[model samples]
Target: MIGTALRGIFTLPDLRKRVLITFALLAVSRIGFWITVPGVNYDVIEEIAGRQAGTWIDFIGIVTGGRLTNASIFSLGVMPYISASIIFTMLVKLVPSLERLQKEGPQGYRKIQQYERYATVLICIIQSSFIVAWMTSVTAGNERLVPNATFSFRLMAIVSMTAGTVFLMWLGEQITEFGIGNGISLLIMNGIVARMPGKFSMFISNIARAVRQGVNPAKEVTELAIFVLLFVGIVAFVVLITQGQRRIPVQQQKQTRGRRVYGGMRYYLPLRVNQGGVMPIIFAQAILMLPIAIISSIPGLQSIRFWFNYGTFWYIFAYVLLILFFEYFWTALVFNPIEMANQLQEHGNFIPGIRPGRRTAEMLEYILNRVALAGGTFVAFIAIVPQIVSSLMGYDIFLATILGGTGILIVVGVALEFVQRVEAQLLAREYEGFMRKPMRGR
Candidate 1:
């Protein structure tokens, strides 16, 4: 199946070109990850990162595929840009003036994008402060990571990292223009996947060692087989949740022109079951980290950090609540039932039995609530279940997430989206898509 898909992709010239461009851009970004920030001792940076293992720094590195510990040029990754975009996206939806601008189509979108870029630079500088403080901090024995407390060193670190992030932003835009799937998402997935191979290799070696140590090899093999199957099942479940949607049927009223009849038509407005995508989990995790980071930093509050440990009851419970809250919060911002109803009414469309105005808005909002509940619940489950299992297995939370939890979920979602896009391009050209079976009969 995989080989056939490759063949299908290579069979088309345009798609092959896009795929190559995407890979090239992704490679360029990865290369930047190794370019250490100027005037910082890479070894000392590593030492500091080592001391802070299992903290937010490590988590960010895993999520973004950036070498923060190395004080690399791309240490900030695309996160600053992503943060800026999310801020601007929510503002665009919430602020009436921005909303009006957004409704103006392509030109408006371009204008908004320019605003996001400006915001990205601001966010990059703001975020770089924390990283710089961490990088320049003097350790217990007088060891210094930056060694230079001078203003030039600090200034360069900030400028270099900010530029790296902006370059990534531009690279992502280029990929989107001349490549497949979404450029930013593809970059995130690339980062996540880049960190996976080493982890997976380690996992396999551990499994093999355990099998060798076992008195019953066959039994161990069976258990490993079951674990593999369960992993596949979970991935499939995520795919279903990612792609699931609640489609509302709409009917358009018939209209007649002077010499022609037009209008009466039926279609469905599809709302994704998981409308929030990874944002809720991302937000919940990030928000929870703040208090944990602060408490851990305090001299006598280290004990309190234990409660916030991954897979603990309070942590999981709070995590679930945050995920649910952010999902609804995001849904409310993105799904405006009143606006939807107005659009439908303008187009002479109605949701069948539902009236065209306030009633339709009411119906849509009600349905959206139900959909969000189902989606949020599923998303929380998908997120928490892996952490619970990883904790039970006594694995490091950092390694576990990179191996399975939110990390794998993001990879699966992005891969599925990318495949769908490629398939769309293929089908549009009267060619077999990725899933199209090869003919075997003579």
Candidate 2:
């Protein structure tokens, strides 16, 4: 099946070009991982990174595909650009001028993107400054991460990190323009996948250790098989949720023209079940990091932190609640039922049974809330699968996360989207789709 898919994908000249360009750009993105920023003590950074194991450092490393511990040029990754984009997305809705500009079509949209680029620069500078400050204060025993905390050193480090992120942003834009899938999403997916070799190595090492200790190799093999099946099932479920949506039937009002009647066509508006995508999970994780960091720093909080440890009951409970909350929150920010209703009415379109204006807005809002609840619950469950699997099955958290949670979610989501794009291209060019074999004609 996979071989057929690849053959079909590469057979198309345009798609093949896109696929190659995407891969070439992705390869370029990884080169920054080896190029560390200046003024950083490699030895101390490694030690500090070792100590920070299993913390948010690992989480960020896996999610963003960037290394912060090493003070690398690409330490900021595509996140700053993504953050700026999100900020502008909300601003377009909140600010009337931006909203109007967005409604103006391509030229106005380009202006908004220009604004987002400027915002990305600002975000990079702020984040880079923080990284520089963090490097100077963090230590491995007596050795500081930034041994020389001079103004020149700080300036150099900040500029290097910022430049790296800007480069990534440009690279992502190029990929989107010429490649098969979304450029930014592809970058993130590539980063998460880069962690795979290390995970497989760890898994193999564990098996080797068990064999050395005289444990049955058959038992290890069975466990591995079970893990693979469960991961496949989880991926299927995620795909189901990601692709699920409710289509509301819309009727276009008829228009009278002298002797002819026009319009009165019907269509559907699709409202996705998992409207939040991975943002809710990202928001939950970002907020959850604070508790993890504060627990060890503040005296007497250590005991309480035990209950809040990853995979604990309280941790899962809190994590689920946050995911649900942020799911609705993000959905609300991105979706405006009132605006949608207004646009529909202005265009002489209305839901089949629902009246236009206030009633339509109310109906849409109600449906959105119900859909969001189901989606949020599902997202929360998927997000915590790694913790549950690790805690209950005694599996490694880092390795399990690859099989579940944000890593798997992002990878699966990107793959599905990429496949859809390729299929669209193939269909347009009158060729067989990836999953479907060419039909036999008698």
What is the Cα root-mean-square deviation between model 1 and the actual structure? 3.6
Report the lDDT tens digits of candidate 1 across residue range 220-307. Answer: 4564465567668888888888889999999989888898889888999999999988888889999888888788889998977798
What range of 10 consecutive residues in model 2 has the weakest lDDT sum?
Answer: 433-442
* Candidate no. 1 TM-score: 0.89
Q: How do the predictions measure up, each by TM-score? A: 0.89, 0.90
As for candidate 1, its clashing pairs are none
Candidate 2 Cα outliers beyond 4 Å, as residue runs: 1-5, 43-50, 137-144, 210-215, 254-264, 291-307, 436-442
Which candidate achieves the best TM-score against the true structure?
Answer: 2
